[model samples]
Structures are given as structure tokens and as C-alpha cells.
Target: MDSSDFTCVDVRRDGFVLHVVLDNPRSDMNAIDRAMHDDLTKLFRMLKQESQARVVLLSGRGRAFSVGGDFEWFRTLRSPHALAELNRDAKQLIWDMLDVEIPIVTAVHGYAMGLGTSIALYSDVIFMAESAKIADPHVKAGIVAGDGGVVAWPMAVGPARAKEFLMTGDALTAAAAERLGLVNHVVPDAELEERALAFARRLAEGAPMAVRFTKMAVNKLVKQALGVAFDASTGYELLTFMSEDHVEAVDAFLEKRQPRFTGR
Candidate 1:
């Protein structure tokens, strides 16, 4: 994919490794707006056809890995058509991320929240910075933790623990994330990117077909879960996006006040 093709993401090649950076146009937290979301859904599909990049190294170009859906985008979602499209895109994005055969190593810096947390955990290997954290704050915004949160979190941290954090929208520190199997390793902030790259390089240097097939073999588990839950989870999430409580939460967020959800 041409670097310019994806306005919100930057892509560069380093040997057989493709470096994909999440650089949100509006903010460093790399919030997901429609453009970013579309680019992401297209990314893995683009990579799947390529023989050049044996491995993908993903990271954010800012203080936070990502913070989730953009507030401005949230304010514009008054139309059912837009919501329906976004819901499908959300499902497509996760499936594509899982469908790719090349190994993906994610470098997590700062906080990875909502879709941020989903992408991070979906990576084949995750290297988190010591001070970084991960969470799905969708519920805090009065929405279901749709996307891959329902699938990946339970697989990583076990169902009981995943429910605790996902339901509460709580954050897990990098160390805690590693302990809970949500992340593979937690390195010092200074070494985070380099360590993640090293791992990607190792995968890139391996016999290409062997690495790709091995990745695909392991992803069967994830695909199985998606088959069972993706449609329902994203469906429910889109419904929540239309709720009065979701509107109040967004309003309260902008006004910097506690949300008064009347359970409508």
C-alpha cells in the first residue's frame, strides 16, 4: 500500500519487516475516526497479498498507543446508515487482522484503550512499554466492548478475569498485562520499540512459508471464536451506540461532568 493511500497511518519498509505506525491526524493518542478505521480494515488485507514483508511491526507515533473512537466522529453519528456501515467495518477489521498469515508484533506505548487495546492484544506478539497500560473503556462510554475485545481478552486472561476488567473498563498496567498474558513482554519505555522490532526481525529472518503457516495454524483458535461471537457482539455494540445512555455519556464527557444515564 502506498504511504499516501492511508492518510491516518504511516507505512515504511525495513528489510522484510513492514513498519506500520498509527499516527492519527487529529491527535497523538491515535484515536480511530472513520478514515483511520477504514485504513485499518484495508491494511492487513493489503499485507496478506504481499511477499515482501514477512512480518509486520505495529506501533503508535505518539504518547498513547490509541484511545479509541474519536469524539468528533462520535458526535456525527446520528444516521442509521453510517452506524450500520461502521458496524460491518468493525467486524471486517478484526477478521482481516486475524486472516493475515504474516506474524504481527505490536509495540505498545502509553495507553491502549478500546480499539487500541483490541489491536494490541490481537497481535501475534505484544511488547508493552513498562509504563504503558491497556484497557477497553467502551463500557465507560456506555457501549459494549465489541470488536475483538470479547474474543481476545477472554482468550488471553481467561474468561473470569476478562469479564472483570472488560465489564468495569479498567486498565491493566504493562507488568500486569504481561502477568495476565494480555502482553508477551514488558520492556523499559526506552527499549520498547527496539525490542519489538527485534522480534519482528527474527520472524522476518525465519523461513518464510514456515513462519506464515505456523501463524495461520495458531490463529485457528481466534477464528473459531470470531465465528461464534463476532456478529452478535458487534451487533449489540452498534445498538448501544444508538442508545440514550451513549449520548449522555458522550455529552457528559464533552462537558466534563458525570453522566446521568436514565437507562433509556
Candidate 2:
């Protein structure tokens, strides 16, 4: 993959590990917009096909890993064309990440919300900062967590617990995440990147074919679960993107007030 294809992500290599860092253009949260989603899909697809790296370390550039969708771009997504395009990219994002043959280690600090949480949790291993948080806030936004949460959350944290958080859009602190088995390790905020890179380097040093194939076999479960939930979830998300409650929610959010749902 030509690094030129990415405008918002900083891609670099450390030995056999590839690092992709999110450079948030619109906000401190590294929010996902259609363009970022499209770029990420392209990156993951390219990684699936031609990455020579044995491991990947995914992280964000600044304070937050990502805090979900960019509200400005989000406000324009009510159109069918916009929603449909994003829906397709959402599915491809999940599919291509799963298809990538190498193992991925996520170093998450700050908030990982919605698409951010989806991306982090789907990785092979997650190293989160003790002060960081992970959540899928689509429900709070009055939409489905269809970016990949319906599959990734349940697989990592189990269905019963998944429902509690996903249904409420509540955050799980990194410490809590580790306790719940959602994150592989939790470290001090300052050590987050170092630990993740160290772990990725360790993975890179392992017997190459065996480690990659092990990742493949383990991810087969993710692929199987995703096949069952992804289509319906994303479709339902698109449907809700145009809902009365969703509009009300966005309006209320912009107005800095609570939404009154009429259930239209």
C-alpha cells in the first residue's frame, strides 16, 4: 500500500510491525467521517493483500483514540445516498480488518467510542491505558452500533454484558475492560505505546508462519460470528439513521439540551 493513499493516518513500519496512527482532522476525538472510513477501508484491504509486516499496531495520534463519528459529517448522513455509502464502507471496514492475515495490537488511550471502539476491540490484542475508556455510543446517538460493535463487542465481552453497555452507550474503563476480558492488558497512560509496540515486536519475532496462521484460525471465529450479525446490524443502522428519534437526538445535541422522543 502506498502511504500516499492515506491523508489522515500516519503509517510507518518498525521492523516487521506496521503502525497506523489516526490523525484526527476535525476534532480531538479522531472522529470517523465518510472520508476517514473510506481511507481506513482502503488501508485494511491493502494490508490484507500485500502487507509484509507480521504484526500491526493501531493507535490514535493525540488525546483520544477516537470518540465516534464527526458530528458535522454525521449531521449530513440522513440522506439515503450518504447513509448507504457509509453502510457499505462500514461493512468493508470490518471485513477487511478480519481478512488481514497478520495479528494486530491496539494501543488505546483516551476515549474509543463507536467506530473507534469497533476498531480497537476487533484487534487480536488490545493494550489500553488505565485512564482510557472504550465504548460504542451509537445508541446514545440514536442509531445502531452497526459499524462493527454488534459483532466485536459480543465476541470480546460476551452477549449478556455486551447488551448492558451497547444498549446504554456506557464507557468501560481500561481497568474494567481488562477485568471483563475485553482488553488483553492495561498499562499506565505513558507506557501505552511502548507496551503495545513491545508486544507487537514479540509477536513479530515468533515463528512467522505459525503465528500468522494462529491468528487466522482464531479470527475464523470472529468471521463466523460477523457473518451472522453484520449485514442485519448495518442495515438496521442505516434505517435508524433516518429515524425521528435520531433527528431529534442530533438536534437536541446541537442545542445542548435533552431530546424529547415522540417515538415517531
Candidate 3:
């Protein structure tokens, strides 16, 4: 796969492990704009054909893994055509990630919010920095936790706990996330990359077929869950794009004020 095709994500192969970085040059926080979203979907599809890649180490550059959707980008989605494209890409990204047979190990530092949290949670294993945090704050933006949040969170921390965080759009510290069974491990901020790389290398060095098949077998259950919840949740999310409240939320966010939602 030619990494040059991606402007939002940086892809580099290190031996048997493919290192994928969520580095959006347009945004210092690594926000997911249209380009990043499409790049991610394409990247995963390419991974399926990467014969040399046995494992993937996914991370972010700069201050965050990702801070979720670019608020500026969110404004453009109010149009029906733009929203329709977003819906298609959103579903495709989740499905492609799940379909890829290679094991993905995510190293999350700083903030991973909204779609960012969903991406990390979908990984086969997660290594989070002790000072970092995760949150699916779609509700905060007056949107549904569609994407992968509805599917991944409930499976990770159970329905009750998932509902609490999802509905409130609250952030969870790495320690708290670890206790809730959301993350696989929590290392110090300084050790996060090294520890995660070691783990990915371990997977890469393992018997290739065994590792791939094991991941495939386990992901069947996730695919089943996605079939049940993903489309409906994404549909509802798209509906919110047309809501008055969603516009207010986006406007208020950009203006840096509390949104006054009237439940339109």
C-alpha cells in the first residue's frame, strides 16, 4: 500500500508490523475530518492485501490519539448529500476494521474522544497511557453514539456502565477504564509506545495462521453485534444531523459556549 495516498494518516511498515499513525496535518489535535475518515477506511482495506503485515500498531502523533470529529467538518454535514456520504463512510470504516484479519494493537496517549475512542476500543488489544483519557462524547455534540461506540462500549464494560458514560459524554481516566475492563493495559505515559510496540512484535512473531484465525474467530461475535446495532445507530445519528439541536450544538461548540438544546 502506498502511504502517499493518505494525507490524513501516516502509514509505515516496520518489519512484520505495520505502524499506522493518526496524524492529521490540518489539525494539531489529530481531529477526524472527512479526509482522515476516508483514509482510515482505505487503510484497513489495504491491510487485507498486505502479505508482509502480520500485525498493526495504531497510534497518534502530537498531543492526542485523536479528539474525534473536527467541529469545522461537522458543520458541513448539515447538508443531506454530505451527511449521506458521511453515513456511508462511517459504516464502511467500522466494517473494514472488523473484517481485517491482522491483529491491531492500539497505543493511546492523551485524549481519545468520540470516534477516536471507538477506534481504540475496536482494536484487538489496547495500551493506554496512565495520564490519558477516553470518552465517546457524541452526546455532547448532540449526536448518537453510533459509529462503533454503541457496539464496542457495551461489549467492553457491559450495557449499564456503557450507557452511563455514553449518555453523559463523560471522560474515563486510564485507571478507571482499565478497572471497567475497557483497556488491556495501562502503562506510564513515557512507556506507552515501547510497551505497545513490544506487544505488537510478540503478536507479529507468533505463528501467523494461528494468530490470524484466532482473531477471525473472535471477531465473528463482534460482527454479529455490529449487524444488530450498527446500522440502526448510524441511521439515528444521521437523523440528528438534520436536527435543530445538532446545529446549535455545533455552533455552540465552535463559539465555546454551553449548548442550549430544545430537543428539536
Candidate 4:
């Protein structure tokens, strides 16, 4: 397949392993968009065929892991239909990540914010860089973190901490993330990729059927909970986009200043 097929993800074969890198080479911060969401669908569909694909590694080139949704795209979605379509696409993208039978290891470095944090959470194992800053700042953008944040955070950490982080949109250091069980391990930036690959290879060596079944069994409860919450919160998140707070948040981001959000 041509590399150009995916604008947000880089696909490659690495000796029985399929390496998918999130490479927006020109953009230091790769942001999620419609194209990326479509790319994710294609990538996961292809993954189903690669039975030999024992492990999948997700990473990003340049400074950031991801910066979440694209600003231009968000600005374009003003109407109810556009917003609903956007949410539907996004929900499918996240579902693909959650349902991928193969093991995934996200090697995160530098900044991982907004949907970036959701991407990491979807992975079976997330290895973070010592200097990485991870946060779900969707609320800062005036959207409820209805995706993986609401579905996964409380399960990963405690509900109290999840509330604090999701509500405040505060960034967490790698060390703090480790304490909260947000990531599997923290490595020096230089060793982040190496460690993640090593761990993935270890899982790959195990019995595939047993591993897949075990994963599904363990996640049954989580799957049920996510199904209910993701549906309900989808509307809540889209409603926020219609509010003035979302407009102000986007404006502040463009203006390069703090947003003074009023609970309107």
C-alpha cells in the first residue's frame, strides 16, 4: 500500500511486525482530523488480515505524540449535522483502537494532550518518556472528554483523580502519571522506543489465542461500561461545541493566551 494513503499515520512492515507511526513530518504537532479518523479505519481493517502481526507499535515523529483535533476542522463544524457526523467518525476511530485484537504499545514522548491522551489510553500498554506531559484538555477546548477520557480514566486511575484531571485539563508529569497508574512505565526519552518495542516483542512471543481471549475476557466489564457512557457523553460533548465557551476557547488558542471560560 502507498504511504500517502494515510495522512496522519505512517504504515510499515518490520519483520512480522506492522509499525504504524503517527508522522505529520511538517507539523511539529500532529492533530487529529477527518482524514486521520478515516485512516485509522483503514489501518485497523488491514490489521485484521495480518494474522502474523503479533504486535503493533504506535508512535509519533517530531516533538509531539499528538495535539488532538485539528483547529480548522473544529472551526468548520458549526451546524448540528456537521457536529454529529464528526462525532460518529470519531467514535468509530476510538472503537477501532479499543477493539484491535492485537497488542498495542504506545511510545509517547514530549507532549500528549487532548485526544492524544485518549490514544495512549486505548493502547494495551503505554510507555512514556520521562519528560512527556500528558493531559486530556478537551474541557479546556470547551468539550466534555466524552471519548476515552470519561470511559477509561476513572477505570485506570481513581474517579476522584479522573474528575480533577478531566475538569481542570491539567498536565501530568511522567512521574506523576506512573504514580496514578496512567502508564505502564517511564523511560528516558532516548530509550522510550527501545523499551516499548522490547515489551511488545515479549507479548508477541506468547500464545496468540490465549492472549487475545484473555484480553477480551478482562475487558468485558469495561466494554459494557464504555458502550453506555460513550453514547450518552457523545451528545454532551457536541452540545459544548455550540456554546460560547468553545468559541472562546478556540479564540484563546488562536490568540495565544489563556481562555477566560464562563460557565454559560
Winning candidate number (lDDT): 3
Tell me the spans in candidate 2 whose CA falls farther than 4 Å from its real position: none
TM-score of every prediction relative to native: 0.98, 0.96, 0.98, 0.94
Give the local distance difference test score of model 2.
Answer: 0.87
Q: Candidate 4 lDDT, tens digit per residue, 1-264?
A: 436677768878676456788876446787776677567667766665567677888898888898777776788888899988878877876777667788788999988887778888877889999999899999889989977789778888988999999999999999999999999899999999899988888888899888877776766777787887887777899899898899889888988999998987
Indicate whether candidate 2 or candidate 3 has the larger lDDT: 3
| Order by lDDT, highest first | 3, 1, 2, 4
lDDT of each: 0.89, 0.87, 0.92, 0.82
Model 3 Cα displacement at 223 (Å)? 0.6
Tens-place lDDT digits, model 3, residues 1-264 = 757979888889889999999899888789998888889878878877778889999999989999999989998888889988888888888888888899999999999999999999988999999999999999989999889899899999999999999999999999999999999999999999999999999999999999999999999999999999999998999998788888999999999999999999
lDDT of 1 at 207: 94
Tens-digit per-residue lDDT, 94-182, candidate 1 = 88888888899999999899998999888899999999988998998888988889989999989999999989998989989999888
Write candidate 2's Cα lDDT for 1-264 as tens digits. 555778778888878998889885766678887678778888888888755888999999878998878767888998999888888877888889988888989999999998888888888899999999988989887888888799888887789999999999999888899999988999999999999999999999999889889989998988999889989899889888899989888888888999887765
Evaluate residue 230 in candidate 4 and report its C-alpha lDDT on the 0 to 100 scale.
88
Q: What's the best-to-worst order under TM-score?
A: 3, 1, 2, 4
Best candidate, TM-score: 3
Error of 4 at 191 (Å): 0.5
